[model samples]
Structures are given as structure tokens and as C-alpha cells.
Target: MARADHWSDTEIALTVADYMKMFTLELAGQRYNKSAHRRALLKLLNGRSDAAVELKHQNISAVLRDLNCFWIPGYKPRSNYQEALATYVEDWINSHSDFDRVSQAAVKQPAFVPTGVEFSTLLVETPKPSTTIQEEHPPYSPNRAASKRDYVAQEARNSALGSAGELLILEYEEYRLRSAGERTLANRIEHVAQSKGDGLGYDILSFETSGQERFIEVKTTAFAKETPFYASRNEVSFSADFQDQFHIYRLFEFRKSPKLFSLAGAISDHCQMDPVNFICRLR
Candidate 1:
């Protein structure tokens, strides 16, 4: 097996296309064989071993992550990818306007929750602490404007998907409590944002097994796990005041099968808190 320092334009394009195919299938809830895809991809790249092809796939995942786009979860994005790969991905995304259109279409349809169905047990990863201090205010797109566009277009404008995601969480919380024989607690679960209002700073009011209250703020997107989300000053301050009870449930790939990761305590402790907008007073 010969190793190349960099992938050719054709090779990168092929890998990106293959990845998109897998992504679309996965989003549609269709099953696919990763090994079979690798074997098939090998035939397209001359003298590239199974391992090399797999690494390239991981590289593609890294590029996607950098662009704030979703990568295949199985790939586990590896970094130090070729710069050209980023360009290739940007081009692919720019060409595919239908990608966003399709995702938006899915969002418009109501979220499907079957009656008497057991929601999948949620497995959440703890937010890792940052090693270095981040900039006070970082530009939305320091380099790749295309990537920035992808992030903003999907996350900000997709309101239906966001509402559906909150509904999913609300049901999950209620179902979880009921399953534990805490029917009273389940009954008490409140959709604060809907029933009360969005000014409450959190969406759902849930409870712990021991009957402790939980303040949950859900952020949902159809994009990948690494995509950035907007948080209001009110939400941040509320999290700070109620650090023990506040939680941010980030739902990624919401249009597909939604999976969540949680950040507890103050929001600033978990994320690089940057102020994107501010109110100005003209006296």
C-alpha cells in the first residue's frame, strides 16, 4: 500500500460525495454498511489501501466539523486535514442548495412520536472544559465565509425544527419519570416556554429522581454536533444564578434521529461565551 502526502482533487471530491451519500441515508433512517462503502471506495482510488481510505473518510469528517457541518458519528473526526479538502467541501456545499431545502422540508413536517412508544434512553456526554482562554469576541468566520453561511443558515432560521426538538425533550422527560413509577412528577413536567412564555429563560421544567427540580434550555439543530448556537444574555445569567439546576440540552441532527449532549452549571463555564449583538441607547 502506497501512502500519499496529500489527496488529489478528484480523490477528495470522491470521498466527499461518498460521505454525503452515507449522511443522507443516515438522516433518512436508512441502514448502511460502512465497511462495504470503504471497499467500494477503494476501487475508485488507485493503490489506496482499506486503511488509507478509512483515514480519508475521517479527514473528511474533520473538515465537516471545522465547517460547523455534521460528520458521520462513526468517523470520529481526526484533524490535520489537507486545506484543499476544506475548499472541496465548501464547493460541494455551495453547489448543493437543495441540501438546506431538504432539511427545511423535514422541519416543516410535525415531529413523529408514536403512541405507547418507549423513547430511546438518552446518553449525554459531559461538556469538556477548555484548556486555553478564548478571545473576548471572535469573528463568526475568521477564514471560511462559506462555512459560516452554512452554520448561520441552518441554526438561526430553522424555527420549526427547534420547536420539534423541544417537544421531543419534553416527551422524553415525562416518559422517563413515568417509567420510574413517579407518575406525579411526570405529570408535573412543564413546557414552560410554551405554556408560560419564552421570557422564562428555560424551555422545560423537569425533575430528578429524588424530586429535585431541573431547568432545561434546549438548543436544537439539524446540523452536526460541533455547530455553534446562540444563547441569550438572560439564559446565561439565569444559568449562573441557578447553576446547580440549570442545564443546556443540545440536540444535534434533530431532523434525523435526535441525539443530545448536555452542559450543566453556568453556560460560561462550558462554552466560549461571545457577545454577538448588543442593545445601544441613543440619548
Candidate 2:
């Protein structure tokens, strides 16, 4: 089977449509088999190999990430995608009105505290910095779908989802203390953000096994682990101030199988900071 240097427009369209179908199913809480979808897509993709098709899906994920739109978790965003990929992605979103509606509702939807998770096994490694050097994809245009609605940021600000995630960690922190034979400390755990209001920089206040203070800021998302989250200057500053005590519990896939990774010390130390919002002053 011969392969072309670039996927033709029709092939890209078919692949994007297939990916979106699975994405919609995932977001709607309906069941869809990824392998089955892949097999079905392979038939229409112009002699593209299995690996080639998978890479294209990942490239599409990268495009969606740039647009601040949610992508399928199974396909992590692979950078250096073809420029045509971005244009086709934009076309898909522009043509599909229901895509925006469904994604918006998914993020705004309320959440409940996740239960039955093995806290011990829930912690996973944080994502490492990308090593890619050359930047191929263009910067987000003002006309992009993400500029219209940032689904990732919306998920970040969903109070119900935020609270559910914070509470989940609050319980886990208490459980951790008690399991470590610090029942007294467990009883002292406080959801500071809930008790004292939101400006404290951190959400939950717990203690380490040795009774040391642990200040946690929890950021939850219903999407994949690599999904970007929003944070305030106050929270970043607070983490730097209390580096020893500060911890960020990033909970992802909250509505489904919930898991998290802990980032300790300053937030700036772990991830690149982007300024999204600004306050204006009259001169």
C-alpha cells in the first residue's frame, strides 16, 4: 500500500468526523469502543497504516488543545502536526454546531464527590515538559472556537465540579492521616476555602504524618491529565510563600475514573504560567 506525504482533505475530513463521533460519545457518557472505531476508520483512510491513523488522531488532539477544546484522552496531543490539520479541525468545529453545545454542557454539568477510589493507587506522575523545539502550528487566531468558548477553562471554573474535586481530596487527606496512625490530625483537616472563603490561595488544610502542615490547592478537570487548568496570581504566590507546605492535587477524569498527581512546591516551578485575564485601570 502506497502512502502520500500528506493526508488528502477528504481523508482528513473522514478521520476528523470519526474522532468527533467518539469524542461526542465520551463526553455524553455513552459507550464507544476505540478499537472498533479505529478499525472502521482505517477502511476509509486511503491505505493509511494503523500507526499512521493513530498519529493523525493524536495530531487532531494537538489542534484541539491549541483551540482550548477538549480532545479524546486516549490520544495525547502530539505536537508538530501538519498545518492543514489545524484548518480542518477549525472547519469541523465551525460546521458542527452541536459540538459546541455538547462540550459547553459537559463542562458546566455539576459533579458529585468520587467514591470507592483507592487513594493509595490514585496518585500518578505529573507530565514532564515537552522537548519539541520548532513551533509549527500557528498561534490561536481570534476567530477560533476556543476564543469563542474555552471548554477547559469553563471546566476549571465550574463551582460544582471544583467543590466535588476539593471535597474528594479533603476526604482523601483525612483518610491518609488516619491510615498513617494520625487519627488526631485526621480530625483536624479543614476545607479552608469552604470555611474561610475563596481568597486563601489554598483549598484544604491537612497535616503530614509527622503533624506538619500541608496546604493544598486542588484543580479538577473532567478531561485528560494533560489538560491545562486556570490558577490565580494569589494561589501561585501562596504556593511560593509556603513552598514546604504547598501542594497542588490535580484531579482529572473526575466524572469518570478519577485520578490525580501531586505537584509540590511553587506552581511556577512545575508548569509554565500563561496570563489569561487582566484588570484594566483608567489613566
Residue 98, model 2, lDDT: 84
TM-score, per-candidate, Cα-based: 0.76, 0.95
After superposition on all C-alphas, the RMSD of every candidate to the true structure, in Å, is: 4.3, 1.7
Relative to the true structure, how large is the alpha-carbon lDDT of every model? 0.73, 0.88
Top TM-score model: 2
**Model 1 poorest ten-residue lDDT run:** 133-142
> How do the residues 173-214 of candidate 2 rate in per-residue lDDT, one tens digit apiece?
877888899999999999999899999999999998888999
Q: Which pairs of residues collide in model 2?
A: none
The C-alpha stretches of model 1 lying farther than 4 A from their native spots are 1-4, 24-33, 96-100, 103-110, 114-117, 124-148, 151-156, 179-181, 222-227, 253-256, 273-283
